[model samples]
Target chain A: MRLITTYLIGLVFGVGISISGMANPAKVLNFFDVAGIWDPSLGFVMGGALIVTFIGYRYVLKRPTPMLSQTFHLPGRRDLDLPLIGGSAVFGIGWGIAGFCPGGALPALGTGSVDVWIFVAALLAGIVIANIIQAAMARTTQATA
Target chain B: MIETVFTPFQSLFGGALIGLAAVLLMATVGRVMGAAGILSGLLQPQDFQDWSWRAAALVGMISGPAALMLVTGEFPAVQVPVSTTMLVIGGVIVGIGVKFGAGCTSGHGVCGMARLSPRSIAATTTFMLTTGLTVYVIRHILGT
Candidate 1:
């Protein structure tokens, strides 16, 4: 049941994403080429997402407990630390190079683009490496709030 | 209106809609909303017997674009071609990542981080950092 629900949510998000991107691809196109084509479109994409997200968050929080559950599972920590900054930087670098964020990538893949596939390959490898590293670091770092 | 050509309202709009969908799914539907995780679960098919939503979600993921194309008349240009082998390998790796990472970019970055989840923040960051670094090393530094 939980698994199935997760899938639906993802599917909805995926649909929402395509609607968002299909409407404004140039913005997504710009985020990658800071110097070249220089499309700042992704900014708009982020903005649109933030708009929907803010409303959704409020809706979720308004409930004494979530409609599906008793309470919303909000995050505890607020402070942005070293890991946050480092991870964002890494993400930015990847976005700069491949011009594909994971959110954007799936829709891009549906088009059956070769570039999307290659990027997906590299992204998968990156995910695996991170998982391996996380397991190893879990022994020492123990993520602090 | 002139800016519509380049603003990328779609991605953000999509994110927001998904945000709503995610919240609803969790609060109402009791789902977690992880893309990579869901896809992997489908490919593997657990013995436990839980797949209706999973199958539906995957179908939705694949079809959303087509539906959009039906209305917008714009589809992905889809340049660059990779072998079936590469695609399969990539899918497997991503599947493994979902198993270990506990979420996909959508689940963690969009949904979890927005809700201020600490684990999600960590997971999202890890994904971003690795992806960024790898792209640089391969496309620029190493010139793959």
Candidate 2:
């Protein structure tokens, strides 16, 4: 039942991405192009989503616990760390180059483009490498201590 | 150069849909709808109970465009402006970056800001600035 709800939510999210023209790499690239011919449509998309989520979170968090899960799994960290900034910067460069973020890229696979597949594969590889590095760091720390 | 087009209505409408999806997931399963996190969890399954919902969300996401095509008899046109090599490079970096940062646009940009998270705000700002700079370098400075 919970899984079904999540699925439905994902479906709506995908449709929203498609309808918003976010699934199109061209549209996404235009959003970042502040100097050249720019498109502010994605701003509206972000604005619209933010407004809904802003209001929605206020109402929902008051309930103490979620409907299906035992507790809400929100991020608790507050510090502005190196990983956050560096990671975001790296992600941004990639986004600017490819014009496809994770959310935009995933739904785009439905278009049956080979390019999406290549991007997705490379994306997975990146994630795997990061994970391995993280694990190695953890092991090294453990051994040192 | 690609022509710039604006569609405020579509963006708002689609963004609302995305917001609603996020809200639904939060309300129902009590999970933040971060696409990268969801995909990562699916890839690395920490627990047995986690994969089901993650997989379901992905399936739902993939089916979204498919369903749209079925109803409208057409799919939205997509164009990859960058070369395949560029695409792969971007994908890998984004993948690594998201992992290190702990969120992406949906996670930090949408849901994080809503929750008023300082980390998310910082992350989002950093990425936006970097993306703008990257674009400037590529288009204006390098003239690529």
Candidate 3:
């Protein structure tokens, strides 16, 4: 019951981005396209996201936790380390090349284009591989610790 | 700072939509409402109970954008600067990075970091720096 709704809202956001010209991979590519009339719609998406996230948390914070679940599930803590820096770089590079970020991928797939699907498959493979690597690393760390 | 970073249209509509969706998801689904986690669920074969919602959510993500464009009007076609090979290579690298970091941008950057998760902060910062460096290298150094 609860879970269904989450996906629906997520879908709404995904669709919103797609329709507004944010989700299109080619369009996303346009921002990095510095040559033409650079379409900065994606930036608007992120910027738009940043604003909503800011206000949303503010309201969520006052609630003692959240109505959906337990306490306000703010992040666990803060640290600047290798993994963080590395992952973001990967994200940026990937974005530059394909112009298909995760969120944008969703709408692209919705368009039912072959290229989008190819990217999606690749993206999923990446996720699975990452999970496997992380699991392996955890095992190694635990054994060492 | 806000205005400088955000466009007028984005600040109002985008922000409102995000807030609306976030609050709605929490109310209806009882989840933190992050794209990375939700997509993960779709990727894995879930127990019948778990999989349906993920499937629906995944559908929503794709369909939502599509539907909007159809109704409103249309935008120009997409275009990529680099070759397919480069794109694939970058994706594979990002996958490795996400795995090493134990989360993606949406996971750590938006969801986890907002909660003050130490791991997320580190992860988000790292992702940002890497992105900046990579862009510089490609555009400035490599001049690609």
List-wise, what DockQ does each model earn?
Answer: 0.27, 0.85, 0.35
lDDT of 3 at B77: 36
Q: lDDT by residue for model 3 over A1-145, one digit each (tens)?
A: 4556655687666655554455555555545544433456555655565556656666655665455455444334366666666666666666666666665566567666666676667777787887787788899999999
List candidate 1 segments past 4 Å from native: A1-8, A22-29, A32-36, A69-71, A140-145, B1-4, B7-16, B29-59, B77-144
Candidates in order, TM-scores: namely: 0.63, 0.97, 0.77
Instruction: Write one digit per residue (lDDT tens) for candidate 3, span B32-129.
Output: 55565666666665586556766777777766645656766753234345566765776666555555565664556655655566777666666555
Write down the worst ten-residue block by lDDT for model 1 chain B: B1-10
| Candidate 2 runs further than 4 Å off | none
Predicted model 1 interface RMSD = 5.9
For each candidate in the order shown, give its overall lDDT on alpha carbons.
0.55, 0.88, 0.59
Which DockQ-derived CAPRI band holds candidate 2?
Answer: high
Between candidates 1 and 2, the DockQ winner: 2
Please report the candidate that would top TM-score against the real structure. Answer: 2
* Reference contacts preserved by each model: 0.34, 0.83, 0.44
lDDT, candidate 1, B1-144, per-residue tens: 012245455555666666666666657644555665554455456544435556666565656667667777976343222234434444444544555555655667766766667777777667655654544454456643
